[model samples]
Target chain A: MATDAPRRGAAIGWYVLLSALSLIVLFPVWMTIARALSDGSATLFARTPSVLPYSPIQWDAFSRAFTEGGLGRPLLVSGLVTLIIVAAQTATAVGAAYAFAFLEFPFKRIVMVLCAATLLLPIEVTLIANIQTLQEVGLVSPSQGFGEAIGALTLPFLAQAFGIFLIRQGFLGIPKDLRDAAQLDGYSDLGFLRRVAVPVTRPVIGSFVLIAFLSAYNQYVWPRFSVKTNRWDTVQLALRRFGLDNPDQLNLGFAAAIIAALPVLVLLLVFQKQLIRGLTAGAVK
Target chain B: MGKRRNVRQWALAYALLLPSLVVFAVFAYLPLYRLVHFSLYQQSSRLGGGERYVGFGAVWDVLSGERFLQGTWITIKFLIFTVPAGIALGVLLAMAAHRRLKGIKIFQTIFSSTVASSVAVSSVVFLTLVNEQIGLLRNVSWLSLKSPNSALFAAALSSVWQNLGLTFVIVLAALQTVPEELLEAAHLDGYGAVRRFFRVVVPLISPALFFLAIVLVVYGFQAYAQIELITGGGPLRSTETLLYRITKLQKNTDLQVGASMSLGLFGLTFLVALVQFRLLERRVTYGN
Candidate 1:
């Protein structure tokens, strides 16, 4: 009983400490939400930050953000671009990983090395030249149409080496006997990949998909530089313009930021497991 | 027949790899080749003038230039401010939430919630939070938003906060991998909690820590939106990282200088990455 008291006290102390830490961690996000929902006039003049939304929550900021801030178009463009990139990346990665994992071929080592080398050359390193390349390809021009701009946005990201490596790891984990068994059952190479390898590696593929979506959705630099016009701005780029272009409507900007972030947040909540797995994929063994 | 079969298999394998190969060639290898090519020649000052061959001069000028050096220093400073602090905070949060206490999941979720925030979102959140006039931290004297020197720190603060979720998640995962018996044995010994953590837990999770360090360093180097959205690399260009400078050159249509700077940034990143692997990999204790 004497020791129990101290242990209980320690537990309570931990609870308190953790609660405070959580608040600190959550404060920025909560404050953003509060400011987004608060009356613009009150928020502009308020000296102390309110912990919650001001009474009679002003929902007009969201409408203004959606329309006047031009968030609606960006949301569509970002979603379409993210979907295209994710789908293409998954297809390309799965194909490349399938070849790497299950097939024997000449110059495989050199090809693998070349693929891995791309990991070092991030988009930032290749930014200026890539822009030139896209321009040369007529994908990004002064008068580039909508489709060309979307191509510019999604082309460089169509295939990722990390995705290949991750999916290959998954494919490599399938036992040789399983492949042999499928082959003996008269399954063709592509057929075996479709039925056996893919089903077995769904978790890895799912993880890759979630991570790819998150990254594609959150992409800032490429879109910011590549897309010359506001017509094709991704949500991130749009938010930047919205915030910078509308300094007076700070609440509107905040509201748009929240609106932009909501999709990924919901995705994170739903796909938390795969997201964590994909993120920590290379961190662990 | 067997030769034909082998040839067919090779064909299929090559076919499967074609998409990635083409993309890599055009976007990755070709750009790298062009960057070198562009850096070797200087564009004429006239708008439509052709190129002039200037082998290594542009690269040397950019690499040795003041802006490059200053940007490099600022990037290094940004790394210094963000990486270690991010790691320490991650470890702290992970340890706090690693216990078997009730409702710990909620705390873990909260700690990692920032992972949902995109760079732009996180930047805007911090920008609003640290605004000069009506910001939550406006009254806080030490972190003055108007100061040039503290602008980098302010940007770093947003980065650190934004990255906390990823760091916490990764570290918490690492913490869960620590063996119960090992900790118990350390506890059974004369080692106190802090000593035991350092002696036993630290080495055990060194790989994850190393991984986190590399990731955070890369992230710190790649940081643009945070600086752009938060400080705009401003108050006398105090937060202008290497990437930021490259983008500035890009904006100015100085592709030659930008290409050289890009290569320089690449070289710097490669060197830092090499140093990290050399210095840190030796200490990482990978559990069997």
Candidate 2:
């Protein structure tokens, strides 16, 4: 009973700490939502916003943000590009991880070492020469449309060392006995991978999918440089223009910011369980 | 039969690996190889002609210049603020939520959400919050910090907030692995909260703390978005980091110098990472 009392007290203290952190995490989100609903009649920065839409909320801010900011085209572009990049990053990472975990080949150790060694180099350093290369390939020319622009934005992040490293760590957690048994039973490599390996590791795959999607969705600078046209801008580019153009319309900018972040937040909520497992899984190895 | 099976396995391995190899070759290795080549050549915009290979002159010019030196100093200053402050906040948050408290899962979710909010999003939110004219702090007179200084502080705040979730998750995971029996024994010995944490909890978690610190330092040097959004490296380039300066060189007036600067930044990042891994490896205790 004495031990139980201490545990209960400790639990209560933890509740207080959690409540305070929740407030800190939720304030910016609260401010964004409040500004979104307010129609510029409300004071956003004030301690007590009296004129905030108290009864019938304004939905017009959403439509105005969409139409005036030209966010639709960028949203579509970012979505499609994000989809493709995530698929590519996941496929490549999975394949490389399979090689690293299951196969023993000539120079296998060398390849793995090289992959680990390159993690420190940020992909930004290679942009200039790459832009020139894209221009040479005619992808950056004026004649090409949104398709080419999206490709240019997605091209650089297609294969990442970090992803390869992560998936390889997951792949290593699988027991080798299963692989050996499958091989002895006359199951081919691809068949065993499809039938056994992938099913067992679905949670890790889901986590990687979410992470890759988030990275692609939030990409800004690459799109800013490579797209070079407002017509082909992604969500981030559109919001940046909103901030720059209507510097006085803080409410509108805030509304647009909320809109841009909503999809990622929904995605996070859906995959929170898998994400936690995946992130902690890496540290375990 | 065994030899035949081994050959098939090797063939499958190579086939599975091809696409990743192709992508990395084009994106990472090819560009790295090309960056070295571009650093030597000069662009002639006036004549609309191709670059002439001018050898190591670009590298020499960049190293000898004062602007690059100033940019390096600023980047180091930014790192000084970001690395220690970011990791400490992460540890504090992690420790606070490490128990089975009510709504603990909800708190964890909120903390980790910032991991997905890119540097651009974080920077934009803070920029609006602290704007000189329309920011939240605009009307307060006791906020004696200058506008530019306030902007830098705001930038640091955004970075720390965004990093809080990542640091907390890592440290909390480490904290959870501490044996409960040992803590119970300490409590039986009449150890107070402060003494117990310092004497027992800290040493076991030191390795995670060390690892988090190294990552924060590397990321601090590579910061670009906050600098771009909040300060634009403005009010006399007070907030510019090395990566941001390299980007400005690439986007603004010059290209060749920018290429050289990028290579320089890459080298610096590489050196720092090496030093961190070497120094910090001594402190990290693997479960083995």
Candidate 3:
């Protein structure tokens, strides 16, 4: 039992070390929460940084963040834009992946190269010209309304090369016999795609969906320029403006930041498996 | 009949692929073409109000300019500061949590909790955390809020923290794939934990490390929200990355200059990707 005792002690040591590391990693988030819960008088004029919320915790920062900080509209707009982009990306990715996996066409090699090339040209590289293009098309102008700006925000992201590649890998995993049996049962190509391929590959699609939602929801650069006015700002943009505009009531800004991050944290909790799968898909063999 | 069926199948396939092809054409390919076209012209106003052909002059000017050089150098410095530190921390965290100890899953979750924070949220959190008046780290001498020189480091700190969750999750996944027998074999051979980690565990997980390195480099180049919210490329443009410079030029309606910088950034990224593959891929062991 001497060896057992040493092993158990080693494990306890590991626990202590890991717990300390986790606290350091999580300190910034904790500080934000504590500051958000404290009143302005408590946080602003304090000489020492408090690790926890001060007495008489104020809950009005969140309400003020939503109402006065103007995060409510942006939150709704971000949600709507995220939903549209997610749905469009899924549809486009599925169709393209299905074609690449199961069908043949002229210029197939060339088209595949074209699709892969887009992976190298990220949105940052094309931001300048895209803004001009969108402006010319009336999709991103001060004169345009919210609908056109939404088009601009969601258009460039309607399809993604990574999503296509990922879903194609999923489709390729379906056995040949499954495809032949579906055909023999008088299922058309589209019918097989809908009834068999999609159901079988739901896990991959789910992962892609979650990843796509996270990316779309957290987009900062595109929305920063595309949306012309505060009327159509996304949540990220609103948080920045609010934080910069309200230095005195920084607690409200912290609360808005928390509110902004709430959805993705909940998604992380619920879809932890899919997120890990999607994130590490291409990283490993 | 066979040829006709083939033609019909090909038509169906193309039909299915049309939406994606069209979107790519409009957004990706066309924008690249226009960026080149716009860069070659001199414009009198923001959106091409009055234009004159200026064959590569603006591009040459941007390439030779001090702003572009400084921005590129700062971006490279930012990459240097963040990438290795991020990978090292990720490896350390993964190693700590990769064991089969009881309740280890909770520790793993906490290690990756930062993944939920968006760049804006993380930047603001760090902003307040480092505020001079009331920040948690305000009194920390090295990261002093009074100095403008610490601006880039401050932004890099946030990026590293924000990326820790993703890096930890990916590395942990890689660590899990290390065969238990291999490590046990190494242990039985009288190798200490440190030696085994560097010799056995690292080589086995080198592919993931390499992948993480490339991704972090790309992320370093693409980082903007952190800089924008934290420093506003601030104090004296010390934190202005190439992408941030291009954004500033765009705001000033200098489309030609912005386009030139964008293409420059693209070429830089391409070169970096090539260099990384050349330097790092040789050591990556693919299979057991």
The lDDT of each candidate is 0.88, 0.72, 0.87
lDDT of each residue in A141-239, candidate 1, tens digit only: 777889998999999999999999999999999998998899899999999989999999999999999999989999898888899887888889987
| Clashing residue pairs for model 1 | none
Higher-scoring candidate on DockQ, 1 or 2 = 1
Residues B107-210 of candidate 3: C-alpha lDDT, one tens digit per residue? 99888888888888898888767766667787886565566677788888999999999999999999999999998999999999999999999998999999
Off by over 4 Å in 2: A1-14, A39-59, A141-144, A244-249, B1-7, B139-150, B251-253
DockQ, model 3, C-alpha based: 0.75
Cα deviation at B141, candidate 2, in Å, is: 8.4
- RMSD score of candidate 2 (Å): 3.2
Give TM per candidate: 0.96, 0.90, 0.97
Docking class of 3: medium
Query: 2 or 3, which is superior by TM-score?
Result: 3
Tell me how much of the true interface, by contacts, candidate 2 captures. Answer: 0.44
Interface RMSD of each: 1.3, 2.8, 1.2
